[model samples]
Target: MAGRIKDHLSIDCNDEGAYYVEARVNHPLREFLNHTDSSYVSQLLPAGATWTATTAGGYIAMIQVTTFACGGISLGAFLSHIIFDGPAATTFISSWAALTRKCGEEAGSPNFDASFVFPQSVAYPREATLSALFSPFLKKGICRSMRIVFDALAIDLLKVKTASSSVRDPTRVEVVSALLCKCIMATFKAKSGIQKSTLITHAVNLRQRAVPQFSKHSMGNFLCMAAALVRANKTGLDNLVCHLRKAIRKIDIDLITALQGDGGWLKYCECIKEIGKASHGTNDKIDLIVFSSWCNMGVYEIDFGWGKPTWVACAPKTKSKIEMVNMIFLMDSKMGNGIEAWVYLEEQHMAMLEQNQELLAFGILEQSPLNLIVS
Candidate 1:
């Protein structure tokens, strides 16, 4: 599938077959699972799975199956974000698992008419405008990726620490995301010796936010980008959570309806402009971190008749260091309530972030997934 961005965004299905690869590792599975380095785990995925246009030799989906010396198997799937969102990918995997297990899975058909619902107009922000607006995120640099797990206990304590009359009962994602933002802000200041205002943008799933709520099986990019600003002095957990909550709430039914209306493109451009404004024009004095939460998306529940997975993970952005920097992918931990954050940051900032005492106080860095299992 190719995403052609001209007058509007449209996906062209070229009937290109999905890419698949099988590999074997000489090392034991336990050896691989014991480490949290993304580069190491990335070996399980098919190399060069990055999505490109069909003419550019890109595949809409890429699959890799790797076997370890100890007979353990790992499955890696890379789906194009242009064509599928988290919920859509989850539905696809679940149905595939059910079919593999011969369970007669009846995963409902997917809805691919998002463009029809939120049709793009001449008012839509052109690719150039978007590129300029989000250029900071598109910069290349020496980036490091790692996973940090926030267990239930830590999350509960965070809720308490961040609880206020104005902000109470913060969701797991909210609290965790806030903490990460706060820590990253501090890390950046310490590294650069200059406190910078931070921009926190979250990818909100539109399936449940829309007025009619798109089905879970709907395909295409059905998401809303919500962002908030945290001044250098207001990076407190409670304050950050408030900002996050408010930004996310702005994507509610009213906003969704507006985005689908005739002036939808203009509304989207306005939102993007507002988000950019939150960072005060994106100079060195401003930091940007993008978050995509896949929590509660049933990622860990995928099974191919071999029982539930011991762990599920998102591959880091190592393959293309130029693509994403200061990004976080949040997914459910094995215990279900906890969140495992897959963070990507510049090398210098990551070196400091990994050693942040305040962050380490509430989160476990690089813990093995096998240890989460209860025998």
Candidate 2:
């Protein structure tokens, strides 16, 4: 399955932070088989495919790049995690693109060098315990689900907010993620009426764990979870922002400790299981799971010389009942700070959230425009 999916190339780009660039290619199944060649792009292309790129302000741009000889169209999309959390499955797109371009240059050269990746051997203490405690959830098919809903009106409001702000902080990615976390937490508490049961989970990368002198290029899943406890009935956007800032600050410590060859991963899994069990029994699960990352930072840096990607976004392959959201920074040719966020939730829950006009005012919500590409 991995081999089949790694056959295509994808690229992301941006122009002065104004917009994002996205490009993808698809080949007929017969053509693919006949080529008998490996390229980063080819490796990333599944048998049948589709693709899309979402931008900030609730705009979705996409392409069904090619129809495979096998009688199916290749599909793809660029999803922003604000709609779910973290980059989700969109990381595969960039990785695939990198691999494809590399293969194009050196037919047999390995596209990715996993030697620098934090070995599972070093991550064992935590993984072992987590596997023992929460393997059941994985066995029962633990999956993640995400939806990218675009809202024109809300996006307009976001523009207004960005324009009104005078701070020169370039951390727009962190700002948006923080805001989403605040809104989601407020909504969860309001609906559940459990003021005291509020917590937020954030993922942190740990490439600098064992070797502080190591270069920053090391990739793969070198990450850990950070949790924050929120006070009940925390209203107002400013208050929420304050809380988010503090939560983000706490991530550094939590992440380092968790990645120190400790059993932190197990503890994290146990915490999640406890939350799940609590949600099943009393309806009070973690208030919100906020996922955010600066994936767009890698957008322009990745290109196959097809100009640059018009947009970049994220899409998750699985769905879960958990309350989660993700945010991503997208680039477009237009001016101003444009960020795109994807949201997924049950209709009832979403409708109830709509009642909070202030939060809803930030961005518009539209049905996800991306199609799921299942292998």
Candidate 3:
């Protein structure tokens, strides 16, 4: 069923289905998959079905299935960020596949209405300025996205490198994000010939953090931002991990309660303000790097009647979603223990980053999905 948007952001559930497309390509999937150029990946994704506040009654989800000459298929889905965050999108895909397989037990019924806890009025105030809310990192620019794979061995080494008395055991996401941030900071310094203060924001899932916690199956944008700052000189991995851990720890029960309160928007505004303040106060240029982890979201487990996907991927660099500079999206690799980071930056910095020995030591840059063996 399609969700029709009413005035004040209310959704009217109707029988109309989501936007879907199916196409056949004469070329085999291996031709594009094995190709060195990553642009071929975008051909499998559906386009021209985006949602905006003004686009009333627009479909909340868009799906495309492209079949190759070799009989291999590519299933691509694009969920509206308005109502679906990473976890919500994963749940939607999994449930859709379960229904296709006639597995009623695996299907999930998502809760579309979350207004009781997060009212529309406070969610987005008419007077709020988006520029101040996101500021430096929320602009369109020429970005180059590179796929970097960190095997389990690299992650274990990173954990050892980041370990300290304060943070005995750091997760894969933390160590990877820290190492990437360190490399990015170095890249910025090399480009500008001066060290710059960097602000790192990681997307935090609030579904399990909120008081009277919402179910994992609950829908809508249950996401919050956690900010960690790395000064120009203090670009150590341990320092970055410490700051990241502290900022993420701040998104506790109290913060979630405030986000769910009547003055929820105010609380959110304050959080953004705090982030802005934290990002400033330095004379040097501030570089904002955004990180979103889709690891352990069960995306690889999404199996239709055809069986599970051989490899899952984010959209190519041509997509506008990651056009903003310094965006890093981390996902669980096909092996389930490793991580694949989609790092987006400006072309020049990306060139330097791709050659960074420190980064390349821990990650394999632009690895082909076709050659990936999921054992």
> Over the stretch 34-88, how does candidate 1's per-residue lDDT look in tens digits?
7756467777778876533233345667889998899889999987665677888
When 1 and 2 are scored with lDDT, the better candidate is 1
Question: What's the best-to-worst order under TM-score?
Answer: 3, 1, 2
**CA lDDT of each candidate?**
0.79, 0.40, 0.80
| Model 1 spans > 4 angstroms off | 1-11, 51-55, 104-106, 120-136, 280-283, 318-320
Q: Which candidate, 1 or 3, would have the higher lDDT against the true structure?
A: 3
How far residue 296's Cα lies from its native spot in candidate 1, in Å, is 0.8
TM-score of each: 0.90, 0.53, 0.91
Mind giving the per-residue lDDT tens digits that candidate 2 earns over 113-179? 3233322344444333422332322212233333233233444444345431333232444445555
Model 3 lowest lDDT segment of ten? 122-131
Error of 3 at 316 (Å): 2.0
Which ranges in model 2 have alpha carbons more than 4 Å from their true place?
A: 1-170, 193-196, 208-216, 253-286, 316-336, 367-375
Q: Using alpha carbons, what is the TM-score of model 3?
A: 0.91
Residue 195, candidate 3: C-alpha displacement in angstroms: 0.6
